[model samples]
Target: MPAEDILRIEGVSMQFTGGAGLFGRRNRTTVRAVDEVNLSVRKGETLGLVGESGCGKTTLGRCILRAHKPSHGRILYRRDDGTEVDLAALSRAQLRPLRTEIRTVFQDPNSSLNPRMTVQQIVGEPLVVNGLARGSEVADRVADTLRRCGLRPELMRRYPHAFSGGERQRIGIARALVTQPRLVVADEAVSALDVSVRSQILNLLEDLQEELDLTYVFISHDLSVIQHLCDRVAVMYLGRIVEEAETEDLFEQPRHPYTEALLRSVPRPDPRLRRRDDVLPAGEVPAPDEAFAGCRFQPRCRYAEDICAREEPATLPRCHFAEDLTLDGVYATDVRQTS
Candidate 1:
C-alpha cells in the first residue's frame, strides 16, 4: 500500500446464496455481485464507482464497509497510527471499535434512516453507541452536527416523515458525520433528489469533504454527476471494472467499449451541445448465471469481434475502430488512447 492510500481492496469477490420454495430448497445458482475487483482509495480523495443497475457498484461499496462479508480476498484499512488491518478477517467484536471510523450514507434516506426515531436520537445514537458522549453532551453534539448539515436544530425533535427528500438526506449526512468517520460510502446519495436539489447536495458534500478531510467511495450511475464530483472514476460492467482512470481522462477519452457506450448515453445539459441520435445495442444485459467464457460485454458491444467472443480483452490499453458509431447523440470515433 502506498503512504497516501488509506484503503485497499484486493481480489474482493462477493456471492450471494439463495433458497427457493417453502421447504427451504437450496438454489444452486450463485450470483457473483463483485468478482475479483481491485481498488484503492487515497486519503481525502473521492473515487467514483459508476455502472448501470445490477452492475455490482452497491455490492462493492458494501463489501468495503464490511456490511457484506467478502467471499474471497481481503479489504485492508490503514489507520492514522500507521497500522493496517484486514477488515474481512475482523470478528464483530474487533470491528466494533472501527465502526466509528467508517460509515455509509445509503441511497434512500427514508429506508435507511430509522423512521421510528426522532432526528436527534437518530444522529446522537452513534455518539452513545461509540461511548463518545452521553445525555446532554450527546444532545449538544447532535444539535451541532444538525446545524453543520444545514438542518434546523429545532427539527431534531421531528420524525423523518416531516422532512422533504433533501432534508431527509441532510439528516442522513448528519448521522453519518456525527460519528466523525474518516471514510464514507455514499451509495447514490443524491440520485433520488430533484435536479435542482442534486447540485445543492453535491456542493454540500464537497464542502463536507473539505471540512472533514474525508475519503469517499461515491457510487452512482450518473456520469455527469460523477464527472463533476469525483477526482477519479472507475467504470464497472457485469461485476468487473472495465476501466479506471482520472475523471478528465475518462470523459475526454474513454478506452473501454462499455465505458464509451456509457459516456455516449449521457444526456447533454445544453440542447446546443446535443449531437445526432446514437445507436443503442440490442438485447438485454446477460444473466449472471450465463457462464460466459470470454468478455461478458461481447453480446452487446458494437465493436465486438472474433477475439472478443473467444477471449476477454484486458481493460488496459485502448482499442480503435475504423468508423465512428453514433451512440445516443455522442460520437464514438476510432482513436488510440491510454490511461
Candidate 2:
C-alpha cells in the first residue's frame, strides 16, 4: 500500500446465495458479485469505477462502505490521524464513528431523499445521529452545507418534493457533506440528471473536493463522465477489473481489449470519424453463477484465441498478449477537438 493511499481494497470478494425449489430444498447457487478486486484510492483523488450494468461496481462500493459485508478479503482505511484500520474487521459499533469519515451520494436523488423530511432534517440527520451536533447547531451546520452546495439556506425547510432534479441532487450532496467525510462513494451520482444538470453537479463535486480535501470513489457506466471527472479510472467487467490507468492514458492508449471496445463505443462528435460498425464484443456478459475455467470474456472478445479459452487469465496487467497487440483507443485528434 502506498503511504499516500487513504483506502486499500485487497483481494475483496462478495458472494450471494439464493434460488429455492418448490420442495424447499436449497438450490445452493452462489453468485460472486465482486471477485477478488484489488484497488487503492489515494488521498484527495477521485478514482472512477466505470463498466456496463451488472458489472459489480456498485457491489464493490457497498463493500468498501461496509454496507455489504464481503465474503472474503480486507478493506483497509486510513484515518485522519494517519492510523490505518481494517474496516472489514470492525464491528457495527466500531464502524459508527467511521461512518462520518465515509459517506455516499446515491444515484436517484428523488428516491434517496425522504420526501417527508425537510432538507434541514435530511442533511442534519447525520450530525444528529452521530451526536456531533444538537438543536440549533445542527440547523446552523445544515444551512452552511446547503450554501456550499449552491443552495439557499432558506430552502432548508422545504421538502424534497419542492425541489427540482438539480436541487434535489444538491440536497443529496449537502447531506453527504454534512458529516465532513474524508471519503465519499458517489454511486452514479449524476446519471439520473439532465445533461446540463449533470455538468453542474460534476463541477460542484470538483469544487467541494478542492475546498474540503475529499477523496472520491465515483462509480458510473458513463465513460465520458468518468473521463471528465476522474484522475484515474478502473474498468470493471463481470465482477473483475479488466484495466486501470490514468484517465488520459486509459482513453488514449487502452491496453485491454475491453477498454478499447469501451472507448470505441463512445460517440465521436465528428461524423467523419464516427465508427460505422460496432466495435464491441458480440455476446452478452456471462452469468455470475456460471463457472468458467478460462477467461470469462473469451466468448465475446474478438481477440480471444485457443489459449484464452483454455486457461484462466491472471488478474494482472496484459494477462493475454497485452504487449503484442496494439489495441485501439479514442483518437488523440478527436479527444483534442472535443476538449
Candidate 3:
C-alpha cells in the first residue's frame, strides 16, 4: 500500500500586519508571508520546502508546526490513531497534546538552545512539560536521546556553551526527537553547521528517521541540502509553491520556470558540466504585500508571456507555459559540496 498523507496543508496562508510607515505616521503595512499553499506530506517521507530567502519557506513550516496560526485554510493532520484534526482551527489548549506528536528543529543552534540549561535539562524539557516523564526518567530519556544523536550521555550535565556547533545541533535534534514526534518540521536545521559537520547531521537525521519511522518537513533555501536529504521537493516563490515533484524528477526535469532558475543557481564543482545556457532569475523579489493578478513569478520568469500577467495558473506546476517549457534542472553534476 502507498504511504498515507500524514499532513495535508490546504490553501494555508499566513499574513502579518505591522507598524505604520517610516515616521510612525503612515498606514500599517500588511505582509503576506505565506500565501495560499497546498501540500501533502506522506508518512516516513521527507518533504523538502525550498526557495530563496524570504520566499516563505520558514513561514510555511511554522504554519505546519502551528507556531503561526494561518490566516486562512485548513492544516489537516492525521494522528497515529487515524483521527484527523484541523490544526489551523484548534485552540492552544486543544493543540497542546498534539504538540507532543509534532515537533520542530530550528535554524540557529546557539540561539535555539537555552544558555543556562544543561543538555539534560534542554532535551528533557519537552518530556517534562508534556508530562511524559519525570524525575530520574527524564534524565534517562535525555541520555538515551543524546546518545542516539551521537553525543555522550556524560555530557548531559554540561551546558550548551561547552559543545561545538555540530554537537549543539545534535542536542537540538535530541530535543525535537525526545517527544517521539511523528512529524518533524526542521527549519534550516543544518544551515548553520560547517560543511564537514552538515553531512554528519544529515546522516544522523536519516538514521533517526529510519529507526523512528519519522516524517519530516525539511525547510531550506539550499537546494544542495534539499537534494541530499529529501524524498520530494516543493519549490516556493513569493509565498506560493510553484512546483513539486519527487526529488530526482524535479532535479532532472523541472517544469516550472522558477524551479528551473533555482536549479540553475546551484554551483557545479566540476566546471565541465556547468550549465551555461541558463540565466538566473533577475529583478528584486517583489515586496511581500505586492498584489499579483496572475503568476507571482511573472516578473522574473524568462518564459512568461502576456497571458501569464493576466491569468493565474492553477496550483499544479504553477506556470502558464509549464507544459510547453522544457526547463533545465540540475543535470549530471553533483551539487553537494560535502561528501
Candidate 4:
C-alpha cells in the first residue's frame, strides 16, 4: 500500500532577477532557481533531496515551507487538523498560523543561531512568538525541547558559540521541534558537521521523527548520507528533478544518466571495488540564467545524442534493474529534473 501523502508540490517554478540598471536601463536577467518541479512526501516519512550546488534542492525545501513563494504552480499542504491548504496561494497574513506547522533547519547552525541569545532564549523564541507559551512556561518548554534534542540543561544557559557544531545543530533542531511542527525541512542540516558528528545528528533526527511522528524533507548533496537516512530519494539537476525512487532502488539501479554519473562519482571505500578505468565527465555546471533547448545536461553528457539536443526528456518509468534507457537509441538523465 502507498503511504499517505502530507505534502504535494505540483509544477512549481521559481525565478530570481539579477544584474543592475545600465544608463537608466535595467540589464535584467532571470535565474530559474527551480523549474516545474513536482513531488509528494508521505506522512511520517523522510524524503531525501539530493542535488549538486545550485540545483534548486534548497530552493524547493524553502518553497514548501512558504519561505519562498512560487512564481508558478501550487504547494498543497495537508495540515495536521485534516485540512488541506494551498500554501503557495496563501498570503502572508493568511499563512501566519500555518507557519507553525512547517519549520526549517538551515545548513549552517552558527549563521542561523543568534549569538546574543542563550540557548533557552533561542529555542523558546518560537513558542513565545507563536503564543503557545509564556514566561516560565516558555523556559520549561525550551528546557524540555532541549533535552529531547540531546542538549544538556547546563548548555541551555550558554550561547550558541559555546557549543560544538553538532550541539549547535541540535539547538537548531530544538528550536524547530519546539513548535511541534508536523513537517520539517532540514536543508543541508548535517552537511557542515564533521563526519562523526554528522552521524550523531542524523541519528538524533531519526529518533525525533520516530518519537514525534514528524515528517521530514532532508536536503543534501551527499548521496551516501541520503542512502542511509532517506526512505525515498529525489535527485535534482539545474533546477529540475531528474529522478525519484525508493532509496535502495535508486542506488542499486539508477536509470537516469545523470544519476548514474553521480553514483559513479562517489569514491568506493574498498580499492578493490573501485571503477578507476571509467571515464569521468568534465565541464562546468551551466549558468542558471541560460535556457536550454532540450536536455540541460547535453553539453557534458557522454551519452547525449541528437535527440537530447532538440527535446527535453520526460522521466519515464523504467525497469528498476536497468541503468540504460532508450530515447531514440539515446540515454536520458538527473540529481533532479529535489528537483
Candidate 5:
C-alpha cells in the first residue's frame, strides 16, 4: 500500500455455482465471472475496465464496491485516515461504516432510481443509511451535491419521473457524490446517455474528479469514451485482464493480439482509416460452459500456437507471442494491419 494508491486488488476471483437438470439439482458447474484480477487505483486517477459484454468487467467493479463477496483473494482498500482494510474480508457490520467511503454510480438511471422515492431521498439515501446526516442535514448535503451535479436543488422534492434522461443521470451522479466517497465505481456510467448528453456527463465527471480528488474504476464497452476519459485502460477477455497500460500506450502500442483486435473493432471516422475484412480472426467470445484448458483466448486467436492451447501465458498482455508479434493498435496503424 503506497500512500498514493487508494485501492489494490490481489488475485480476486468471483464465481457463481448453480445446479442444472430437470429439477435443477442433478448437475452443477461453477462459472468464474472474474479470475485472479490484480489492479491498483491511485488517488484521483481514472482507471477504465473495458471488454465486450459478459467479459466480467462489471462483476469486478461490484467486487470492489463489496456488492459481491469474492470467492477468492483480497481487495485491499486504503481509507482516508491512513488505515488499510481488506474489503473482501470485512463483515457486514464492519463494512457498513466504510460504505460512505466507497460508492457506485450505476448505469440506466431509469431502472436504478427508485420510482417511489423523491430526488432528495434518492440522493440522500447513502447519507441516511450510513448515519452520516439526519433530517435537515441530509437535505442540505443533497442540495449541495445536486447543485454540483448541475441539477436544481429545488427539484429535490420531485420524483425520478420528473427528470429527463440526462437530468436523471445527473441525479445518479449526485447520489454517488453526496457521501463524499474517495473511491467510486462507475459501472457503464455514461453508456446509456445520448451522444450529446454523454459528453456533458463526461465533462461533469472530469470536473468532479478534480474537485473531490476521487479515484474511479470506470467500466464501459465504449473504447472511444475510454480512450478519451481514462488515464489507464485494462482490457479484459474471458474473465481475465489480458493487458493493462497507460491509455495512450495501450491504444498506440498494444502488445497483445486480443488488444489489437479490439482496437481494430473501433469504428473509424474516416473511410480510409477503416480496418480490412480479413485482418483479424472472426469468432465469438467463448461461452461460460466452453471451458479452456490453457489460454482462454486460443479459441478465438488467429495467431495461437499449439503451446497456447497447452499452457497459459503467465503475465499481463496474456499472450505467449506478445513480445514476438508486432501487433497493431489504433495509433500504430490506421489502415489495415496484419499480425
Candidate 6:
C-alpha cells in the first residue's frame, strides 16, 4: 500500500444469509452485498463511487466507515498521526476513538438529524459524547461549525423542522464536520435538494474540503454530480468495482462496457444531440443471492460473446476486449472539435 493513502480497502466483501423456514431444513441463501473489492483512497482527494441503485455503492461506503462489518478482507485506515489500523477488525470499543476522525453525511438529512433536538444539540452531540468539549464550549464549537457550513449561528437554537431542505443539509454537513474528521463519507449528500440548491451545497462542500483539508468518499448514482465534485471515479456493478480512473479520463475514455453504458446514459443539455437508441443494457440487476459462474454483466452487455458467459473475468478490467475496444465517451465531441 502507498504511504500517502489514508484508507486502503483490500479484498473486502460483505455477505448476509437469509431464507430459513420455521420448521424445515436450513436452506439459507447468501447475498454478497460487496464482493471482493480493493481500493485506495489518498489523503486529500474526493473519490466518487458511482453506480445504479442496488449496485453496492452504499454498502462499500458503510464498510469503509465500519458501520457494516465486512464478512471478508481488511480495511486499513491511517490516522492523522500516521498510525495504521484495520478498521474491519476493530471492536466497537476500539473503534470509538476513531469515529471522530471518520464521519458520514447520510443521504437523508431529515432522518439523520433528531427532530426533537435543536440544531445546537444535534451538532454538539458528537462533541459531548466524545468528551471533546463541555457545556458552553460545546455550544461555541457547534456555533462555529454551523457558521462554517453557511448556516447562521443564531439558528442553532431552532429545531430541524424549521429549516428548508438545503438548510437542513447544511446542518447535516455541520454535524459531520463538528468533530473535525479527517475523512468524510458523503452518501448522496445533495441528491435530495433542488437543482439550484444542489450547486450551492456542492460549492460549499468543495470550499470546506479546501479549508479543512478533508478527504471524501462521495457515494452517488448521479454521474453529473460525481463529475463536478470528484477527482477520481470508481464504477460499481453487482457488488464489484468494474472500472476506476481519474474523472476526466473515465469521462473521456471509459474502459469497461458497463462504464461506457453509464456515461452514455448521462443526459446532455442539447435535446437534438440525444440519441433515442442510447438505451442501457436490458433487464434489471441480478439478485444478490443468485450465484453466477461467468461475468455478471454478460447477461446484459451488448458486447457479450461465448467466452463472456463461460468464463469469469478478472475484476480489474473485467472485459476480454477492454484493451482493444474504442468505447464512446463524453469527450468525443471535444476531441472532434480539437481535431
Per-residue C-alpha lDDT of model 5 across residues 1-339, encoded as one tens digit per residue: 888899999999999987787887588888999999988888889999998899999999989988999999999998888989999999999999888889899999899999999999999999988889998999999999999999889989999999899999999999999999999999999989989899999999999999998999999999999999999999998799999999999998898888888888888777557674554657787776568788998887888889999999889879999889887878644565445
Runs in model 2 lying further than 4 Å from the true structure? 276-278, 332-339
Task: Summing lDDT over every window of 10 consecutive residues in candidate 6, give the lowest-scoring window.
Answer: 330-339
* Steric collisions counted per model: 3, 0, 0, 13, 0, 0
- Encode model 3's per-residue lDDT on 46-98: one tens digit a residue: 99999989999898998888889999999999999888999999999999999
Scanning candidate 1 in windows of ten residues, the lowest lDDT window is 320-329
Residue-level error in angstroms, candidate 4, position 105: 1.1
- Tens-place lDDT per residue, model 6, 176-225, is 99999999999999988889999999999999999999999999989999
Q: Model 5: which residue pairs collide?
A: none
lDDT of the candidates, in the order given: 0.84, 0.90, 0.90, 0.83, 0.90, 0.90
Q: Report model 1's TM-score to 2 decimal places.
A: 0.90
Q: Candidate 1's residue-wise lDDT over 182-291, tens digit each? A: 99999999998999899989999999999989998999998888988999998888888877889887787776777777887776555445432333455788887667
* Runs off by more than 4 Å, candidate 4: 1-3, 24-26, 276-279, 316-339
Cα deviation of 254 in candidate 2 (Å)? 0.4
Error of 5 at 287 (Å): 1.6
lDDT of 5 at 139: 94
* Candidate 6 local lDDT, residue 29: 80
TM-score of each: 0.90, 0.96, 0.95, 0.91, 0.96, 0.96
Model 1, runs deviating above 4 Å: 20-27, 269-279, 314-339
lDDT of 4: 0.83
